[model samples]
Target: MTTSFPDPAAFVGKVAFISGAASGIGAATAGRLARLGARLVLADRDAERLAAFAAQLATQDVLALNVDVTSMASVEQAIAAGIAHFGGLDLAVNSAGIDLPRCATAHYPAEDWDKVIAVNLTGVFNAVRNQIPAMLARGGGSIVNVSSIMGFRAFAGQPAYTAAKHGVIGLTKAAALDHAAQGVRINAVAPGFIETPLLAHLSEEKKQEAAMLHPVARLGQPDEITSVILFLLSDAASFVTGACYEVDGGYLAR
Candidate 1:
C-alpha cells in the first residue's frame, strides 16, 4: 500500500535520544531530526567530539553525554539524563558500533570478537533495555537499530562484524515482538557501505572496489541513510515494525 510521508513538523517538540552521535550516520540523523524540531540527546564514547558537535547546535533543547553503550550502567545513565532533561522520550536510534580487523572466523582474534559483540550487539541491547521504559513512560515510542548489509549476508574476513550485525537484526525482531502490542515499535536499518569516517582508512583503490560492489556503482552518502531512518522513526512508518529496511545502493539485490 502507498503511504504518505510524514510532515517535517511531525517530530516537532518530540524528544529523540541518539547513540554514536559524534560521527557517521548517527550524527547525520541527529542533525536531520533536530532540524525537524526534535529535542535531542546525543551520546557517544568520544566525549570531546560529542560536546563539540553538540556545541554546533548550541540550544537548550540539546543534551550531550558520554555514553559507552557496551556498559549497561553507562547507557542507563545517559537515558536517565535525557529523560530528566527533556521530561520524556519519543524516539531512539542505536547507532553505536565498531568494525574490527578483517579475518576469517577461525583466524579471528578472540579479543576482537569480544569487542565487536560487546559494542554492536550488546550495545543495542543496552540501549533498547533502557529506552523501552522511557518510551513507555511517555505513552509510546519508536526505535531504530542500525544494522548492516553484512547482517543478512556475509563477507570474507569479517566474521566478527557479520556475526554482530546478524545478532542485531535478531535482537530487533525479538524486541519488536515483545513490545509491539505495548505501543513501542522496533525495527532495524541494514545499510550497505556508506561514505563515513569509518571508511576513511581504506585506500583509494579499495574504496573504488567497494563502491563497484554495489549495483548503483557508488557509495551511499550518510544523509541518504539518515532519510530512511527519519522516515522509520516518524509516524509515516506507523505500520512498520519488526522489519529490516535496507538502505543499500541496491547491493543486496545483487
Candidate 2:
C-alpha cells in the first residue's frame, strides 16, 4: 500500500465511486484516481463505452455500472454495486451531468430546462444522497461535485445550464456543512471552458470563440480538472470542506 515518494493519496485500499465516468472529465478523474491506487467504481449511461473503459482498467480494481444519474434507483444500484465490489465506498465524484439548449432565458424552452435540471442538478443530488450513507458508515470520506464557472457567473445564452450549476454549488455547501462534522468532506469544482468531447458539437469558429473567453487565452483540459479533483479527494484536503475550487484559469477573476 505504499508508493515511491509516499503518496499522501495512497487510496490503494480505498474505493472511489464516480458518476459520468465513461468520458470527458469523469473518465480522466477515474484514471487519475486509479493511478493513485484507488479502487474505482465508474458509472455512466453509455454502456458500450463504459464496458470498454472498464475492460481497460479491470486489472486496477475497477467495476463499471451503467447508470442514469437522473434516476434514484439507478444511482442506488450503482452505489450498492460499489460497496459490493470494493467492500465499502470511501469517496465519490458526482460528475454526471448534461448540457443543451443554448438560449437566453426568455427563449429557453420549458422541456429543455427540465432536462438540464434533471441531469445536472437532480443527477448530482441522487449521487450524493445515495453515496453519503456508505461514506458515513465507513467513518470518513470525500465528495467532489463537478460544477462549472457558470455556477457563479453567467454566459449570454445558458439560463438552464447556469441555474443547474448554481444549484450544484448551493447543494455542495449544504452537504459539506451537514457532513463535515461526520468526517465526510463535500466540495465542488467550478471549471471554466474546457475542451472535451462535449465541445465537439460546436463548430470550429464557436470553439475558438469559447476558448478566447478565458483569460488564460485557451480552454482547459480534462486532466487539469482531474488534478484539482484528486487533491480534494486526497488526505491533502482533509481541512477543506464546503469549498468551491475554481479551476477556471482565472475566468471568474475577469
Candidate 3:
C-alpha cells in the first residue's frame, strides 16, 4: 500500500474499526468513514443501538459487535473478529467513554473513579494495545484516541472525569512513541465541550454555561472532531505521531 494519501483522506477500501460506535463522536466517525468508502467494524456496549446504526449506513462491509472497552478480553476479541471478518485492520478510533456526575475529589466515590478510568482511560489502552499489533502485522497503520480539553485543563467537581481524560493524553503519547518506529501512527484529539449525548444530563442553563467556556461561545459538534480524526488517520499525517490535536475552539487557550 502506498503511504501517499489524499487531502480529505484516502479511506476507500481501508478497513477501519471504531469503538463507541452507537452514538456521539463515535457514531459520527463511523458514519463519515462509511461514506468515505472504508470497510467498518463498529463496536459499542449498546448492542441494539450499534446494530441499528450499522444498518442505517446501508453498507455491506460492516460488522457490528457489542464490546465493552474496559475488558481486555472483549476488546481483544473484537479486534480479532474484525480482522477475521475484513481480512486485515488498517485504522482505528477509540472513542468509547463515559462521565460521572460532579463530585469533589475528596468525596468522589471510589467506584465512580474506577468506572470513569475503566471506560475513559483504560478503555483507550485496551483498544490501542490490541490495535497496534494488528496494524504492525500488516506493515503499518494509524490509531486515534479521543482525549478531551479536560485532559490538560481542570474541571471542578468532576475529579474522576478529569483524571481519566488526562490519563488518555499520557497514554496516547506513550503508545505512539513506542510504535511509531514500527509504522503505527498513534495520536489524540482533545475536543472542547461537545454537544453530544454525553452532555444530555446537563440542564439547558448548564449547557449554555458550558458553551460560554469556549472562546467560540459554542460547543463543538461531533463532525468537527471527526474531520480532524480522518486527517490524522490518513497518510496525510504520516509524519505526525504522538501528538495531541486540540479541537477545543479555544477552551485550552483560556
Candidate 4:
C-alpha cells in the first residue's frame, strides 16, 4: 500500500520562510514544504535546535536563522538575508509564539504581559511587515500566520495569550485586505491544542482533559495544523484571503 501526498510540482522553484521552525507546528510546516519542493528559510530563537533540524532535512537548500521575533531589526534582517539567499520569497509561515504563566487578569504581571505580547503579537507584526515588501517585489505571494482558538474564545487565566491571538486574527484580516489587490494573500490558521512543545509541560491527565474539551476526544497533531497552513499557502487556496480557518477539532463548535 502507498500513501499519497500533495503534488510537489506545485511548490517547485518556490522559496518559503518559516519562523518558530525549531519545533511543533513551525517545524512540521517546514518539513512539509521541504518535501513539497520548496526551498526553505527556517527561523527560531533556539539556534542549536534550528541548526540541527535544518541539517536533518532531505534537501541542502535550507537556510537556518536564529531570530528573536520580538526584535524588528532581527526579523527584517532574517527576511532580507533569506531573499538574498533564495533570490525571492513566495511563501511564509509566521508561527513564533510564547505563552505567559496563567494568571488572573487583574493580577497578570506587567513584565510577563509585555513579553507575551512582544513575542506573540508584535513579533508577528514584525514578520509581516518585513516579509510584505519582499513578497510584493516578486509580484505576489502567500502568507499564513498561526493564531489560536483563543483568538475567538475567552480562556480563564490566559488573558495575555488570548489578547495576542485575537490581535493576530485582526492583523491577518487587515493585512489580507490591504494587499489582496497587489497579489499578496495573507490568511491565518486558528488551531486547537496540539501535541506541541508548548503543551509538553502539562501533566498527562491535564492533556487528556484538554483533548476531551474538543468533540474529537483527542489532541491534534502538529502535522494536522501544518496541513491546513500548507493549503492556505498553496495555489489551491488562490481565492483565499482575510480568512481565518479554524483547524480545531470541533473545539469551537461547542
Residue 44 displacement in candidate 3 (angstroms) = 0.1
lDDT per residue for candidate 4 within 151-249, as digits (tens), equals: 999899999999999999999999999999999999999999999999988999999999999899999999999988988888788888999999899
**Model 3: runs farther than 4 Å from truth?**
1-9
In model 1, state the lDDT of residue 12: 89
Per-residue CA lDDT of model 2 for 1-254, tens digit only, reads: 32232365467778999998989899999887877788899999999998898787635688888899999999998899889877999989999888784788888899999999999999999999988899988998999999999899877788888989999999999999998889999999999988877788899899889888888889899999998898888777878899999999888997
Please report, as a residue range, the 10-residue window in candidate 3 with the lowest summed lDDT. Answer: 1-10
lDDT of 1 by residue, 169-237 (tens): 999999999999988999999999999888998999999999998999999998999998988998889
Give the TM-score (vs. native) of candidate 4: 0.97
Give me the overall lDDT of model 4. Answer: 0.93
TM-score for each model: 0.97, 0.95, 0.97, 0.97
Worst 10 residues of 4 by lDDT: 1-10
Which candidate would rank higher by TM-score, 3 or 4? 4
* Residue 81, model 2: Cα distance from true site in angstroms: 1.3
TM-score, predicted candidate 2 vs. hidden true structure? 0.95
- The true-versus-predicted C-alpha distance at residue 54 of model 4, in Å, is 0.6
